[model samples]
Target: MALPSPPLFIVFNASSGGADAEQASGRVGDLLTAAGRPHEIIRVRGDEELTRATVRASHAAREAHGAVVAAGGDGTLNAVAQVVWNADQVMGVLPQGTFNYFGRTHGMPTALDDSVAALLSAREQAVTVGLLGERVFLVNASVGLYPRLLEERESAKRRFGRRRVVALLSGLGTILRGGSVLTLELSVEGQTRVVRTRTLFVGNNELQLQEIGLRHAVDVEQGRLAAITLQPVSTLRTLWLLIRGALGRLDGAEGVDSFAFDQLVVRMRRRVRWVKVALDGEVLRMPPPLVFRTAPRPLRLLLPAAEAEEGSA
Candidate 1:
């Protein structure tokens, strides 16, 4: 049986990845009709319409006492998240992105039927977000080769299929070849920590501790940020760890400095080259010396498998 009030808003990306958003809408509508969950499919017409439309959806969900289910990729998720963060609405994701980092980490369903089933059954949690002033991110925020590599990935996605592995290989290859590492003069837990590295990752929830070289298991929902600062012993060694980490072995590497903290401030030394940054999967060109902080219980999100697993633990 469906809840008294069904999901009132499903943010649709009709032009997402050039796939017919209407197709996704129709398919999801079929699921909703079958499951008896009430929802409205919102088609975003233009970038200019996003803010207003998002706000409108947020308001509608609140009035209907329903959830706002994001129906596209990370970029679309970020957009919908902006308006619905603090309001009385639950957030659900239907995972249709090239790399659904947040969804994959949480064990979200990939198939349409299974994904909708999870959404209809899951409990909601007030999820934390990594915030940079006005910017809010559900996953990690990073600077360096991360964002540039994403640009390359998008280009690769266009050239190859969205599911191609070579796009990842290309990004991995770029990271393996030494890119310009930067220095961050920062403070942690009221002490000074100076870091110099090419890869700086601030994970908001949990750093995906894979079978990779990174050995530390850091949890983000514990009201802290997990940070990994890396210094290459040698270019070759860095490449080895990167490959191992990609293969899920980063937690065991020696040169990787991992820690948990409430905030991080990076101090810039000079005008750096191409500071391509990322807030989740959305890429950005950022000015140096970024400040990152955690907003505790910032947004309510559907956590099906992960929350179930957490309860069992």
Candidate 2:
């Protein structure tokens, strides 16, 4: 598998997770250099610079017939993907996050040397992505308690460290504390049903869905998204549900409902102007009614040799 014969424009964020971006970039540079692949590393300082940096990288990649690479977490990848997808350029990943869901899902190596090596021989593949309204999400999108969990997990990471245990503990804490219930009117496949729950999660990544023990994971490969909603329950039951999710036995768990859909329209039964939604682990306020669906066009992702071959096979 041969990638585009041009320099790879990599957008790296220094503050994403606890990884040393300098060391990581240095390793990537060395690997690419050894492979004789010309590349440029764009270091981003803050979230404010993400769009500008990605746009710049996209333009450079477009001009050179190269691919734009994201070397941070899923959020960074999401930002870069938005620009690369819009620019109609191939995108690559160097996973540098605590949970590199997107990268792992696509069989991208997490090690810098191996990932760069993989990128050097990667092939382009079009992969499905989710859309939260007009915004693109590669992993998952959610509203309600799930987003709150992400917020709390981030705060815990800042206070403690960016480790899987910290993230797990923080999420458990959020779940134990409990949150406001949402009254949602969910419309899917021409059927509308009113439900009350703490969160509504729409998953596009099959690996993530499988991790959480949802059979709906298969739906993603079939050109559909997996939707999960929690029934309003006591804090203890919520905790039990969380345990089930962690144990990969959440499929038939009580108080949890999982289904597959191509499109879903969610409306708040209560009046509210904006809804706090999490897209690929980034929280933002989006105006309702929230629409979750498969993007019209798939993202041109640069997959590793094995995955690319499997995708073709």
Candidate 3:
């Protein structure tokens, strides 16, 4: 028999998705109450507060195996998941962010009411998580052009406010601005090779890869990481890949190679002291020689049963 579900501890970012987070949290609380599910909602302002709140929730939920739900975008979910990953506490998502990639990948609804309902009637599964040093990410991690795109997106958001159009314009600007390629020395599968690429992407979720027709990996739950490298190519070629990705046919895109591995050591041939890398939409500057591995410990996540079945099928 399965263990009893505990009271939910929700970590909500009110300023997310360009809406009043307080109003959103209130609405979620109302929904949970109406559903007769015992839940406690905690509002956080930034990453630090989110970490503290999740820690509190994790302790509070220990008695009942309750889940900790992140009510925001991939960045918010990433922060919360890092705190609760591989722990007894389960992780859930409300997906109130602009891209909702993590939630959608798990077959969860993006709407507030539907998301809460799904969480209340969800099951726990051991999901794979990617590890970059000490940080845990539920989505994908990358180096190169992707991080530059994220920087552009943040600048755009600050200047023109957060909107889908802004994100698009930001991406366009990044692609047009062009990016420098990295000479990477990679050690994987007991063989070492050198790659000159503009971007190196590591994916932890197969649903995301399949959505974009990336075919980076066949299974995310297989305790392995899916990595893709976009060779140094012309800006137009990169743009063409984006266009193909938009149409869900990126597999055949030229200059793109995908592979699977359990762990890998990546180094910059030029030996920079630090490099910009993006994990689950959050960018960070880390020391060179980034070591990436997969944690098969399985992060327990909540998703709608119907959608889960559909996704499995």
Candidate 4:
């Protein structure tokens, strides 16, 4: 089988691994070189560099006609994906940052050498990306308390271990037990429903509870978004529901709710200055009202060949 036309890839925030992208890039670079792949490596310093590199890479994807590989976490990926997605460019991931829930969930390898080897050896798949107020996300788009807490946790993840275990723990505690109970209105399928909830989630993909202390989504190619909201209730009951989810016992529970839709519109009970939204792992604010829609099959992603052959597709 011939490779799907060797692609030119752009890596954003290659220095995101903390020290420098040297070891990460070098290890991956060696593999690509051995595979006789053609690619480019660009270090993104700040917001400007991020924008420039992404746009250039997107245009290059059209002119040179190649895929853009976002090498960082969710934030960096969002910045780059927004530029190339739907602009006739395929997007890819390297998973060089914390958690990499979205990447690993999609069978993207974690180790630098293996991930690159697999990425270069992978076949492309049609996957959906999420759009939350001009920003693009590979896995999910979230608001209310969780996004706020995620910002602080990301730094801690960098300082500690890139696994982000502590942050996930702290985040789970903060959102479930300590999260805000705000009134929200949703417009789905042209029917608006109102509810007072502790947290609001609209996923380009759904999170499976069977995986404890783990975040994995339903396939992005499903062409739909999954939603879950919690109504204000006793703290203990809330804790129990979480425990159920943690212990893999949540099914048709009383306080738990989940739904799937193609589009969602959400507004908080209070009109604050701005509401924070977490895309992938990047945090940004959604001003007052947020309109979310599914971009189904908007991105063509390259995946490990084994995934495609083993009935994983």
Candidate 4 per-residue lDDT over residues 1-313, each given as its tens digit: 9645666676657545455576666666777777878888776765668888887777777777688888877667777778777575777888866657667766888787777877876777766677776667766777766576777676666577556577767666665557667788888898998888777766654433324322323433356676777677787887787777678665566765667777788877676888877887667766868888776446677778876465343
Q: What's each prediction's TM-score? A: 0.86, 0.97, 0.91, 0.85
Ranking by lDDT: 2, 3, 1, 4
Compare candidates 1 and 2 on TM-score and give the better one: 2
Candidate number of the best lDDT: 2
lDDT of 3 by residue, 97-152 (tens): 77787788777888878887888888776567889987898889999999989988
Better of 1 and 3 by lDDT: 3
Q: Which 10 consecutive positions of candidate 3 have the poorest summed lDDT?
A: 14-23
Instruction: List per-prediction Cα lDDT, in the order shown.
Output: 0.71, 0.89, 0.83, 0.70
Of candidates 4 and 2, the better by TM-score:
2
Off by over 4 Å in 1: 1-3, 17-21, 45-52, 86-88, 205-207, 211-215, 232-234, 271-275, 286-288, 305-313
Candidate no. 2 TM-score: 0.97
User: Model 1: which ten-residue window has the lowest total lDDT?
Assistant: 209-218
TM-score of 3: 0.91
For model 4, the run of ten residues with the poorest summed lDDT:
208-217
Candidate 2 local lDDT, 162-206, one digit each (tens): 899999999999988989999999999999999999999999889
Q: Which lDDT value does model 4 have at 204? A: 59
Candidate 3 Cα lDDT to native: 0.83
